[model samples]
Target chain A: AQSVTQLDSQVPVFEEAPVELRCNYSSSVSVYLFWYVQYPNQGLQLLLKYLSGSTLVKGINGFEAEFNKSQTSFHLRKPSVHISDTAEYFCAVTLKGGGNKLTFGTGTQLKVEL
Target chain B: GAGVSQSPSNKVTEKGKDVELRCDPISGHTALYWYRQSLGQGLEFLIYFQGNSAPDKSGLPSDRFSAERTGGSVSTLTIQRTQQEDSAVYLCASSHNSYGVEQYFGPGTRLTVT
Candidate 1:
């Protein structure tokens, strides 16, 4: 079985400040990692994914994540954030060849303070 | 392009009643998935359908939850004997395939059990 854990339930950062949302996973087999964003009363939208090759993965809206095998983590980062970046972010993982099913985390709420 | 769509954005039902949620996947997509989202718990996979094949129901929390995809384009999730614990936002998503594809999500139906 595969599982995903998000370390912080919420992270507050000033607008234009750097932010990092941590995510960890537990799985013995090969896996794929993904990040999603959810705004107020909206559905989740794909942010980024790490399938293979490059460890640093860039996503939409100036977000990125790094897949670290040694650390067993896929932490999302943003060099600079805007007020509109405040949202709930989810980290997910799935066993290789598991198709499209995802094991999601409890989510990290990015609260952008003006 | 049109994205995945779900019907009945909100639902209020009495305990013991059955409710059915609908999903219309993106055209030409071959995989559809159902998930649950609540206040604390992020997103939990409920079921997944691939083309016309049997669905993967391993993630379903209970037998009360069941889903079906017809004509390979749409899906319906039926919750039997609605319990207060079943209250959550039911989300529907679709992807081209399971091979690490990004799943597009719908607005989700918020089900409230009374």
Candidate 2:
């Protein structure tokens, strides 16, 4: 079984400040990790993904995440956020050879304030 | 290019009634997925379809929830005897292939069971 855990339920940060949303996963086999963002009244959008490449993955909207295999973590980070960056972020994982079924975390609400 | 689209953006139904949510994937996408999002449950995988392979129903909560994809392009998720717990945003996503590719999402159908 595969599971994902998002450490922060809510993260409040001011505009132009750095932000990091923590995520951790538990899987018996190798897995692919992803971060998605969802704005109010909208569906989720892919932020970044770590398939079989470098540990650090950059995504849309100037967001990036580093895959830490030993720590079983893939945390999303942004050097500086904007007011429009306020949204809910989710960490998800899919196991290798397990098809495309994604196990998502509870989610972290990123509230970027001015 | 137009992204994934879901019909009946908002659906309000009685507790015992049935509701059908629809999803139209991108033209060349070969994989489609269904997910549910709610305040209590952040995001959950409901089901997935890939080409002509058997649909993965592992993530579906119960037998009351069922989905089908026709012509490998459009999908319909049917909820029988809906309950208050079934109230959530039903999201649909599509990808060119299921091999760790980025899935594009639709706006989602907000189902409110009263």
Please, what are the lDDT tens digits per residue for candidate 2 over residues A1-114? 889999799999999999999999999999999999999999989999999879999999999999999999999999999999999999999888888877899999999888
Fraction of the reference Cα-Cα interface contacts (below 8 Å) that each candidate reproduces = 0.88, 0.81
- For model 2, residues B1-114, the per-residue Cα lDDT tens digits are 899999999999999998999999999999999999888987889999999989999889999999999988899999999999999999999997757888999999999999
What DockQ class does candidate 1 belong to? Answer: high
Candidate 2 docking band = high
- Model 1 stretches astray by more than 4 angstroms: none
Go through the candidates in order and give each one's DockQ: 0.87, 0.85
lDDT tens digits, residues B28-98, model 1?
99999999997756689899999878899988999998888889988999999999999999999999875
